[model samples]
Target: MARLSDQILTAIFSLQRHLLEGINETAATELAIFEQFGETEITIPALEQLQNARQRLTDPCSRL
Candidate 1:
């Protein structure tokens, strides 16, 4: 049972990382689109936040 629980937790973490990667990609694409439309003021902060979130998601210590 403990082994199963560990497997479940590992799977959840894998899924979380996958989702975060998708979100990061989307954020990057959106930032580029925003730049093309001359919306730096709005997108800059959003991009920064996304970057911070991505960093936190990828950080090993965050899993604890």
Candidate 2:
């Protein structure tokens, strides 16, 4: 069995994935779950939209 911390991380990761996938219902549920788990300070969203994943792919040798 996975360690307790690993399980918590996995659960958090799953919730974040659901949030990223536009599953709006999970946001509140996630918040409540965190609160119940004694994570009251976690008021921010689990995941956020970034400006860009990769600004642009550049060839490593091109910079030389």
Candidate 3:
């Protein structure tokens, strides 16, 4: 039982790490585009969507 619990905890941590990595990559890509293009009519909505996605990714509990 102890070993199973440890495995579960390890898996959870690994999943969280992967999720964070994905979030970071997404933010970086979006930021790069924004930096290169500045803000346009289209980018405004895209930026807002990105911000919301980031918030949800970092704080899934808050949404509930």
Candidate 4:
């Protein structure tokens, strides 16, 4: 279960990073889809994992 969650989170955080790279119409639409899909279908456990991954990826400390 945890492994599955980790995989899902990895994929999601990758997309989330893409979303942050540049914001335009397409990205906005995709981000909206991400929000809906994540909130509705993604399991709570997976969401938590994704959030953690997102933070890690976006954190300045991770860059160094």
All models: lDDT?
Answer: 0.68, 0.43, 0.76, 0.56
lDDT at position 18, candidate 2: 47
Angstrom error of the Cα, residue 28, model 4: value is 10
What order do you get sorting by TM-score, best first? 3, 1, 4, 2
Mind giving the per-residue lDDT tens digits that candidate 4 earns over 1-64? 3356788879777876665553343445445656777655555555555566556545643443
lDDT, residue 15, model 2: 61
Error of 3 at 20 (Å): 0.8
How many steric overlaps does candidate 3 have? Answer: 0
User: Model 2: how far is 64 from its true place, Å?
Assistant: 40
Off by more than 4 A, model 4: 1-42, 61-64
Instruction: Give the per-residue lDDT of model 3 (tens digit) for 1-64.
Output: 3455888879777778866876787698679879988789978888778878777777853332
- On the 0 to 100 scale, the lDDT of residue 59 in model 3 is 83
Instruction: Give TM-scores for every candidate, taking all chains together and pairing residue i with residue i.
Output: 0.49, 0.29, 0.73, 0.32
Which candidate has the top score in TM-score? 3
- Error (Å) of candidate 3 at residue 14 is 1.5
Task: Give me the candidate number with maximum lDDT.
Answer: 3
Q: Tens digit of lDDT per residue, candidate 2, span 1-64?
A: 8567988879777765544544334444555566666443453334221112111112221231
For candidate 4, what is the TM-score? 0.32
From the highest lDDT down, the ranking of the candidates is: 3, 1, 4, 2
Lowest lDDT block of 10, candidate 2? 49-58
